[model samples]
Target: MSEQNQDKHQQRQQKVKQKVDERIAAAQKEQGIFQVITGNGKGKSTSGFGTVARAVGHGMKAAVCQFIKGTWECGERNLLEKAGVEFVIMNTGFTWETQNKESDTVAAQVTWQEAKRMLKDESINLVMLDEITYMITYGYIDLDDVLEAVSSRPAMQSVIITGRGAHRKLTDLADTVSEVRNVKHAFDAGIKAQKGFDY
Candidate 1:
C-alpha cells in the first residue's frame, strides 16, 4: 500500500478499537455502587460534594456524614442542605486541631453509627462519607464494619468515601478509586487557606 493509504488504514483501525472500548466500558457500567477518593492532596471531599450535587440535580436523595474537620463552615454543606441533602456532622475537627484523642474517637463513633444507617438506606441514592479515612487510620471505627456496610449497600445506590490515607481494603472493594496527587499547593508557600477555596 502507498504511504498515505497505510496511514489511513491504521487510523481507521484505531477508530474501530476506540469504539469497541467505549462499548465495552458502557456495558460494564452495570450499577454505580462504591467509589473511593483519597490522597494527601485536597479535593477529595470536594469531589464527593460534586457527586452529591449531581445526584441531587437528578432528583435523587443524598446524604453526607462528615467524619472529621466538621467544626469549620462548609459552603458545600450549606448549598446541599438547601437542596435537601441530609448531613451528619461529627463536629470534632481534625485530631491535631482538637488535641484530644478521646473526643475525636467519640465523635467518630457517633458519625460512624449514622453512616451505617445511611449506607443501609435504599432510599438514599448517594452517600458521601467525607474524611472517613482518618477515622479508619486512627482505629476510631472498625475497618471490617465499614467494609461490610459498603458491601451490603443497595446495588443501585452510589457511595463516595473521601479522605487521605484510605485503607487498601477499602480501595480493593471500591468500584472506582481516584487519588488526587498534590503537585503544587499555595499552602506550601505560606499562603493561608482562603474562604470559598479551601474551607
Candidate 2:
C-alpha cells in the first residue's frame, strides 16, 4: 500500500476507535441480561447452549430446561452436565411425535415447575429455556406464567429463551433479541442431521 493510503487507513481506524471508546465510557450499567434467540433457522438452541457454556467456563452456575426435546441424547447436555450445569428435560419428545395433548401438557407443566424453581434460585447465574416458545405456542405452558417467572427472577440472573417464532412480549422484554434467518438448509436437500454437527 502507498504511504497516503496507509495514512488514510490509520485515520479511519483512529476515528472508529474513538467512537468505540466513547460508547464504552458512556455505558455504566452492570447487570445480567435477558436474551432471546428466535427464528426459522437452525442454531437457536446451539447459540443458547454456547452462552451457557461460556457462563460455566467462568465458574458461574447454569441450568437448562428443555421443553420439546424429549429423551433424545444431546451433545451439549452431555458435556454441560459434567461441568455441573443442572438440566431439567421434559422427556416428552416432540409434540407432533407424541400426538397426545393431555400427556404432553402434563409433562410441560411438570418441567415448568423445575424451571420456575431454577429461575427463582439466585445461585444460578444463567438459565437456558430451550425450545420453550413451542410450549407457549401450543398452549401447554401459559405465556403469562413464563413472563412472570422471568420478570421476577433475581436481578443478576441471565436468561436465554431459544426457539422459532418467539412471542412479541418476550422479545419486547428481552435486553437482546437475535433472529436467525434461514437462507438454506441441508435438511431440505434430503441430507440427514449429522451427529456432532446437527445435534
TM-score of 1: 0.89
RMSD to true structure for each model, in Å? 3.1, 0.8
The parts of candidate 1 lying over 4 Å away from their true place are 1-29
What is the clash tally of candidate 2? 1
lDDT score, candidate 2: 0.95
What root-mean-square deviation over C-alphas does model 2 reach? 0.8
Show the colliding residue pairs in model 1.
none
User: Model 2 — which ten-residue stretch has the worst lDDT?
Assistant: 68-77
- State the C-alpha lDDT per candidate: 0.91, 0.95
Q: With candidate 2 superimposed using the best TM-score fit, by how many Å does residue 31's alpha carbon deviate from the native?
A: 1.3
lDDT of 2 by residue, 41-135 (tens): 89999999999999999999999999987578899999999999999999998899989999999999999999999999999999999999999
Per-residue lDDT tens digits of candidate 1, residues 1-199?
9999999999999999999999898886567579999998878889989989999999999999998878999999989999999999999877888888888888899999999999889899999999898899998899999999999888888999999999999999998999999989999999999989997
Off by over 4 Å in 2: none
Model 1 deviation from native, Cα RMSD in Å: 3.1
